[model samples]
Target: MANETMLQAFEWYLPADGHHWRRLQEEIPIFQKLGLTKVWLPPAFKGTGPNDVGYGVYDLFDLGEFDQNGTVLTKYGSKEDYLSLIQSLKEAGIMPLADVVLNHKASGDSKESFSVLRMDPANRQSPLSEPFEIEAWTAFTFPGRRDTYNDFKWHWYHFTGVDYDAKHDESGIYLILGDNKGWADQERIDNENGNFDYLMYDDLDFKHPEVVSHLKDWAKWFLDTSQAAGFRLDAVKHIDSEFMAEFIRYIRSDINPDFYVFGEYWKNDAAMTQDYLEQIDQSFSLVDVVLHMNFYDAGQKGSQFNLSAVLDGSLMQASPDLAVTFVDNHDSQRGQALESTVEEWFKPLAYALILLRQQGLPCIFYGDYYGISGDFAQQDFRELLDKLTFLRQHYVYGEQNDYFDHPNCIAWTCLGNEEHPDGLAVLLSNGDKGWKKINMGTLNQGKVFIDYLGNSTDEVTIGQDGWAEFPVEAGSVSAWVDRDSLVN
Candidate 1:
């Protein structure tokens, strides 16, 4: 497989105008030109309602195909529009990575009386309310999508718990116990809330063979219907790792063997992420949340941040192959549930660090590239992202050398391959401006180098020993490519 760069093509604050899919279709050629190998599309399935962001998954089969949720179209456009967008992306040589939410299902059809015990939100193992019969909204018949795809009618038995009850008109975490019904195994999941299995609304019981079979069928159907290259699994830490591995294997075997899958583990600890990866037998890659946190800390601290320790305790440093590096995501964006937004000034440096390196697969967030919506209106980083992606596509290859010796500044060099002539030297600073004496490995001695990012206009000529003193401004990043390579 080729070194891939993915783009998270949607943000949480995207307007519910039902034109995202169409907009993606229109931007397919532009994304191809930007050298995006894959585009991680937002959930195309119908959400709790028409305006929902699709994370509150209602009907997996109903991808704007039926007249449900008060509207036939999703936040994105109709089913036909989504399929067309996927086809366009493929035609443009870009893989469409569908966002798959399988951990839970929300917005059920009706309420059913069931014996439930309220569990503490902080400690899910500790029950707060005694066993009592209450009318909970867990029945999902998909009345609007009546048997169009697979007729898997979800009931209270298919779920382990719910968060709300219509009878009391109150909100509390309730676990449906009795007859082998409970949360997933605590030993196999994150210790948060005892077991992090139950996230929101009707948490699907992966232990049930019938539920697993239905999900498997839906996965197959989704792949076949969308023709997506892979999936960006949502809330993997809350789901069973073993079940995830099996699902990935089953889908890969059933569909294309080369089908890729990555997940949002959302753990700040690299060890926990590594353990999850081990538990799943390395079936899927995970977003480098640890690295993102590091970037976030650095961005927040500004010039005082330690540049040398940027990659410390990061998955990219330990296992680059399975690390999906990203600067910001939907959850990490401003005003989201897991908001730890990276400062705008540090994004270019972050992008250069991830994109110009011969390491983890980098994902460009749409909020950064195209600017975000709502209260947090971000400045567009398209030009900077474009230059980095261009270098990544055409020049990033071969051996890498890390000059992470400076406290306020750090540098790295990538020796170019035969396919991509000339090397790349990257210099970043979170503090005062500085220069680093980097050796380009004598492959291009006496060659002139210029900053591809246009941050610096000065050029440096390599010495007989292939060493050049590269300078960058404070709180900025620069990528110096061979001057000869810059001549189109």
Candidate 2:
């Protein structure tokens, strides 16, 4: 079981003044103090423009290095600032996980006439328009970058499809056919729209050897330049699974053998995620989207939600080792796509489950830690998260025993270890005030325990049997640790 905790260092709503990397550098010490072992930084490359959130990738080689797309610095900061941020994180004993966007490239340099078959947005297999010539923005020379790192230029031949035509001012999915280049195999990807291989502007043709070679080179360059501990591959479901597996193998073998890699599949079905994992030869971990959806559903339903079934149909439950558990991410937060924000009241309980559990590596979102600006300014879980992080760092270890017997209340205990010396008892309730009797192991016999979260003021002395009733408030969660452990 991996015990390290990761913190997402950026949110979607962060100020676009291009100073995020500087701020992250300043907060490195604070992150270390919070017991975060790894920090996941947002995309460091220049996006479509100055205000782009780094997702609308224009130039992969330009990490805010040149004055491209009307900005010398990205939304986060300049290339120098990004490198400094990674160095600062390493110095603070936290590994930096770089966000890698490899699905598609956007913001072309010019337009070109091409014959394409328009496909239905709903059903990509079905054609909507006949093969017609139209001016599409598919040429990317990166003139501003001027061949700084890699001089590879992209054109329509390197892509599988496009979504817009500049001449007709039309918006539709156009399948770029010819030269044996097309969308990835439908059988290897999500079933949505026949095939989800084409996501945004100028989808890269993974079938093309040149495209794969260029991407691999870029990956090596990225790792060498940023010195990131690992990669967070974006939109894996939209890319070919075989290509991803090959990419991971190439990067790990040629660059960093022990490099960690995880992907964002973004499917609500655990089976789909598992299938993708199998397709990738289980080479990388995946964000547990199913678990996140469960959290969202539980938060929306509140007390009516069945707490006992919280882990059902979740990737964490099915494959804990390969699941990166999280409550909310940038895409799930307000004002973004895939918005399924967990209710504010259930955040503490959610964090307790993920952080204190033995299964799944927990990821703390920056939006949840530092409140979002604008409409969601009042929502901040930093204090609670701090407490949870402290408990996770100190007491979340050893073997675990679950007591998930109730529909609205559930509890578990982590047996004490020789290193930590004391164990933890966690209790949660979604309906009303409740308690569960859990064994903290025979080693904890006669020890006094109190809720570290202060949810309950009462102290419970463990009987000789080493079991005690842990109580939590209605619609809340608590972690009970040995009182003596606090002093040492």
TM-score of each: 0.98, 0.98
Residues 340-380, model 1: lDDT tens digits: 99998898988887888878999999989889766888888
Q: Candidate 2 lDDT (Cα, whole model)?
A: 0.89
Any residue pairs clashing in model 2, and if so which? none
Q: Residue 185 lDDT in model 2?
A: 89
lDDT of each: 0.89, 0.89
lDDT of 2 at 74: 95
Residue-level lDDT of model 2, residues 51-84, one tens digit each, is 8888999989999889888999999998999999
What is the overall TM-score of model 2 with all chains considered together?
0.98
lDDT of 2 at 16: 92
